[model samples]
Target chain A: MKRARMENELVSKGHVACPGCGAALAMRYVLNVLGPKTIIVLPACCWSVITNRHPECCLEVPVFHTAFETAACVASGVRAALEVKGDNSTNVLAWAGDGGTFDIGLQALSGAAERNDDIIYVCYDNEAYMNTGVQRSSATPWGAWTTTTPATHFKGQEKKNIMEIMAAHRIPYAATASISMPEDLMAKVERARDTRGTRFLHIFCPCPTGWRSSPDLTIELARAAVESRAFPLYEIFDGAKRRLSLDPAPPAPVADYIRPQGRFRHLDSEQIEAIQKRVDEEWLSLLRLIENNPA
Target chain B: MKEVMMGDVAVARGVKLARVEVIAAYPITPQTIIVEELSEICGRGELKARFIKVESEHSALACCMGASMAGARTFTASASQGLLLMHEMLHWSAGARTPIVMANVNRAIAPPWNLWSDQTDSLSQRDTSWIQLYCENNQEVIDTVIQAYRIAETVYLPVMVVLDAFILSHTSEVVDVPEQEDVDRYLPPFKAALTLDTNDPRAFGSISGPMEYQKLKMARHEDMMGAVEVARRADDEFGEVFGRKYGIAEPYRCEDAELILLTSGALGGTAKIAVDALRESGAAVGALRVRLFRPFPADEIAEAIGDAPKVAVIDRNLSVGAGGIFAQELKAALYDRERRPAVFGFTGGYGGGDFTPEVVEKIARRALEMGKPDSPTLWEAIP
Candidate 1:
């Protein structure tokens, strides 16, 4: 069956995003789903510079470019202002990069989540600080070689479990999504849109420049990532009820996901095996959570 | 209604009268009570505003900026360390032209963990393009806060209403809180000249080329310069409605004075008392209490201090490498004009020490004997 095209003039044609930029795709799908009545608070990230220079905007929605580590709190204030202005229908969205969400902006995000502010927060996880010349961030996976974590000194620490952190806040809806699966991604956005309190979406956006991968393979690699259980697609409802969007059953080997990206090119066989072991352990841990919550 | 209240409570009352739509603040000593009263007012539904108990001062100001960008009248208060933490967003709010009215209880900056009154806290942020209004007492604190909205909205610049920590913040005084209807008639609801509207989708704070960036900065600078007249008119109109007016700079008994004490904040009140006592002693001295610090009120100040042989600037706050901030700015303001006085800068009353009228009298007596300032700042009450 032919899938009808989902389109909105929400994202203009000539945004300065890199080709095959999953972050750009993620923004498009999110904006299309959320519609033009949405206001986005963008922090210091690639998109901060990507959305055309001053006096020229690239989106159909108003984007409030704010300081780093301020997206969530700014959105909280925006939502409150909108409510006071008798605009309960307009969506206030906080869009940030992984560094902004998982590291510098974590406190603000937690503050908003704890308050259960009436806003949606989306952290488009590009896995590293792709905006600032591919620096290592907390979201940079183990064994990934960013500029800061170079050559022999690949990222030794594991990617921070941001989902668990947001879940601990017990917000109304928290979900992990991927640009490879736009339908499921848009679905989660719709769910978040319907929810009144703080809704978080952790979107896996593979960076072509930062990952040193061909632009054409961005989506395929994103799909491979989920199938290998490297970045599972799941949701946590009120921090308890769990549901998987896509089952990583009979999962492909982690190497299948790792081989194409140059960021992981320095990994030896033993390192890959260790990573695979970690992946399996994490997958089992997630499966148990899904079973117990049974959403 | 006439009710005796602390300066903090008067600030909260003034914010309510202005009908501020959003208030986001973090608790800081000397500035906490203002937010506390606002929180209770918001909680009890006495004031129709959203009060966000933000986690940090940085978030407090950032939240205010966001709310203001979305076309809501926003307010926040912080001092000393909290104000320093919000330094970056201070520039952000003003550069974004948010028109957020913030009350800053001037507290001494740390190193020794001081929580006393000091003007250095807000004076350090002078370049951030925020219109700074220094109040002499609780009456001026409330009046300036309500007038801040009008001044800020008119010029599209943020306004910081500054009062001395504890000297004014905790001190209770009989203040005639203006009626809300009167305020409403005096100042209308804020309608942003440009806003983040769903009907009009646009991106704010996008990266700009140097040319456009410089142009924006220049435009903001021009508007900021015009805020003095706007503040003057707003205060005049506020007086017409509420029957109280504090000019940008108030000159008292300077008509035939031999010496004039240039002062700001609560020190102005003390200076007035000191001037009256000096007059009783048959000294031809007067007081010039400057209410507005930014858009400096140079013309009014220069005119007020005309031919007064010696002008002693009582600076309760000092700049470490330089001298008193107001004294420094005053020299610059008077440099281009003729008929200027030998300005004697006396720096004292830091770390919350009492800046008594006696100290003012002592400083004036010392200035009366001086030909000109021996140094940039004379460290008073120090061996």
Candidate 2:
């Protein structure tokens, strides 16, 4: 029965992603949902490397590898072109990384959102610049230690509130998903695919190599993130109505999410307590927002 | 009907006539009027197109790249700093062979924040594989925009139609804006061989190893070189429809002249007056207006000069370490020839300064008197 229900895998088996890479798994789910009538615009990211090089791509769909900071704008262009070609069916997807979304590509993202361009912008947040050896990005957690932020000088600033920023665009759809919940991720991908204008999907993807976690624990870490509210699973429709996807019963402590990752190994007890308090406060605020803004 | 219009409006008319499908632009001074007029044209529902008011010049070109890759005729306009901002995407558009046409108003790059006529801004992008057409008058500006689409689509290379900032972009002239039917005959609907089509799924600009990369680059180069012939053919086809044709290099009375001066953009008009004055005074001089800058038209330029003993090449833009750009290119083109003329390099009319007839005449006399090319660029300033 499980075999009969499964969708044909779009991403090929042999690929270059590190073992237990949440990003690769996330891509599998995205492609399976998006199907063949999709054109993906990939900026510089781990996926740019994970996908097999020229003459051999992991996905069956056509992929356009563009310059970093151009995924959103390029996708807008692609969407516009498709509209001109009288193609109202194919999905135009901008698949980028945290650095491409939260850092250098912010302006382009804002431009595409403001225009209400018809496209799906998927930003796979791995917390840091993993492709370039785990340099800290704006998406990196408050206390995580990346190569740029050593144990002596861990990241001090909180991760940027990308969901709020995206919501501010007032786009047609904005959602947060986790690789651990493939069904939810696929559902959001499908929702974004169905939405007409500037749909944004922020997927929390764990990097086993960058986060210094056991390769096999990638899924567990991803699930713990959502249960701990470190990375909540939610959706904001029409950019105003907020709805939570998962309500974890007896939700896990933030420590359960942070404990296994080497990036968070430098945090002492007091720092861990501070992180837990911050997560709890954020979770409470999110609940209030969901209650306040009914769909 | 000949309508009195600003140079920028002439460009807009050309874009409309060509039936460009996508216009992505971010306003910068001097070039703003062009897009503003285009915006009005698009708003009135006179033209069927998508007007994308992009956030920045980088997105402007990238949008055009996307539209062109999707097989739509695309255009954009910018000047100075905005053009500089689009440096990276310019290479991408060319390498990807997206046939996009853009109008670049020649303005001085800022450090001192100057917005005047200077060629350095577009000349700086010499290696981006974009076909550059420098217009001397408003009519040529309008005509070249249409021809640009024809040539660019033919060569599958981006085209930058350049005009002097304010001197031409803001100046008004009587331009015969071609009717849509005529322009339609001149430039056919865009049909691309390769595009982002779901019906025919294929990846573009994927990762390439050194050997494949070299071949792609070589193919692009061959196509760019082929544009020289394509541009000439486009000019001929345009003349058949519009009755006015500007060749790669249009020479004024160089048949038996001993001295010839070369100029580009609006400086050509000034040089023409200087050539006539020199001729009336029996100096046996002529002027050649270089319309096409890229696919440099070296042999044509050499042929036009045709053994003139002395050649004075005026450059409104400089290369700092390398004298004058046009002079250097002319010298290099004539270097191996058996009967090479002595090419004099003169720098003048930079930063909005007028290149009056007297200034041009003086440069010509100096070139004739020196009888040989100068080691450095000779500065000609209007007193």
Candidate 3:
């Protein structure tokens, strides 16, 4: 399949993001698609520190660095003001980490989504609180090792179904894309930009520092997750209809997705089987939604 | 035209007259009416503005910060816990130098879960770079709201206009709502010196080193001190156009008086009545209403309490380990003075209780008997 081409990088080189940081790639794609007429509402996250300090911001767009839990709400305000100022072409983008979006910022995100605010909220899911040094977040999948959820007591709960949570808000658009699939991510961003109401894009951003994985394996891991059906690429419309993005030949073993990362190195065969069971179950459930409410 | 309205409604009218572009608020007790009225105004198309109904107080102020940063004149109102919830964003809004104005109904902070008149909620936020104005009446509430925008915009700082819960917030009085054209002349459209604009892109509240951060903080303080002069000038100009002028501090019958009672918020009204009663008996007592708490109004306070032998500071809030918040500020203001008066700090009305005129007089008489404050702060009018 021919991949869509991107031109003119908005995210300049020499950012502070760790090598092979999926969030950096995701941001580059986002800014490229959204263009320069954008105002970003960035909450406290890795991206907050990743952007170089004052007088040296990499992104050539206005950014409002808000408190930890106010990305969506702040974006809502920016959109409203721009509407009042009669500059409707400028897109207000709320970029947050998984912790900011799924945990601390959930109320504000829900509020903005419920209001059908005119903004695109992007939650870069690094699975755990990476910027704070590998602390466990609600997005930390089952059987994952974080500083808070040490190897002896791995994460007991499955990652929070944030896409479903956003879908429940019945927003105009909500999609799950990946850092490896820049075309799909950019296409979703383009769609969200054209959409008038609240559009949520949950991107699976891999953090090599937090996951203790070989930095070169970041994109490989991102692709392996999707092919393994652990993190299936899909999109939901108006909180109901769903459309699957990929049709792989056959599902790869969950081990292909998990074995490379040190966070999952402690998992035994039975635990891996348990995780595989959960992933397969989740994939089946997602397929059911896609089949029932075809988009 | 003169219209009978509660202090909260007067606040809405003031916001309307100022042509505020965006308003965000959560419905908290005593502060709900202001938001409700603002919403109504927006609904009726009387005020061409966006009224964002935020989920919590934190989001309310955050929304205001965003709108203000987007170069909109923004406003919000809250009370007690709601105001407490907005504490972080209060610092954000001020440090970012967004001249957003907020009305805070003075309600007791909860532990006992009371929702009546107390100044502790707003007073506790004194360190945040917001200009604090305490209103003594519904009229002052309206007038100060208009002046707050001018001073805040001039100084690039946020302003928190405080009114005593129930006493001023719920009680109705005749307030002269100024005409919209006159208000327009007094307060122009907000032209933000810096904001989130695509044409001139810059980050708001980005990371800064200690040296740059210190300079930014110093500049904000300079702006805060500059607000004193701006506030006075705005009031003088407002009086020229609106025919009503209120100073940062109002000295009532304080001239040649031996004992002057210092108070703020609606308690000043009660103190004024108490002063009149004492004057009838030739007690030579007076009242000085400290209207502007921030910018501290130190010089005005010193001038008002000048040469007076004693000052009984009636504080409806306490600093716990320290003395009364206002009394401590007043003492600091007089610390470098040559003719320093004996400042007595008396605290009352904690957790939604009232400090009536009789209680205020009792505190005054006590201060008069003691000649000077022997203790740091004495509890009075407590049940």
lDDT of 1 by residue, A238-277 (tens): 9899998898789999999999999999888999999999
Task: Write model 2 residue lDDT over A71-98, tens digit each, in one string.
Answer: 9888888888778768889999999999
Write down the lDDT of every candidate, Cα atoms only: 0.91, 0.89, 0.90
Clashes of 3: 0
* lDDT string, candidate 1, B249-367, tens digits: 99988878999999999989989999999999999999999889988999999999988888988888899888898989988999999787888888888896777888889888888
Docking class of 3: medium
lDDT (Cα, 0-100) at B372 in candidate 1: 73
Docking class of 2: medium
Q: Give the root-mean-square deviation of each candidate in angstroms.
A: 1.5, 1.8, 1.2
Model number with the top DockQ: 1
Candidate closest to the true structure, highest lDDT = 1
Question: Which pairs clash in model 2?
Answer: none
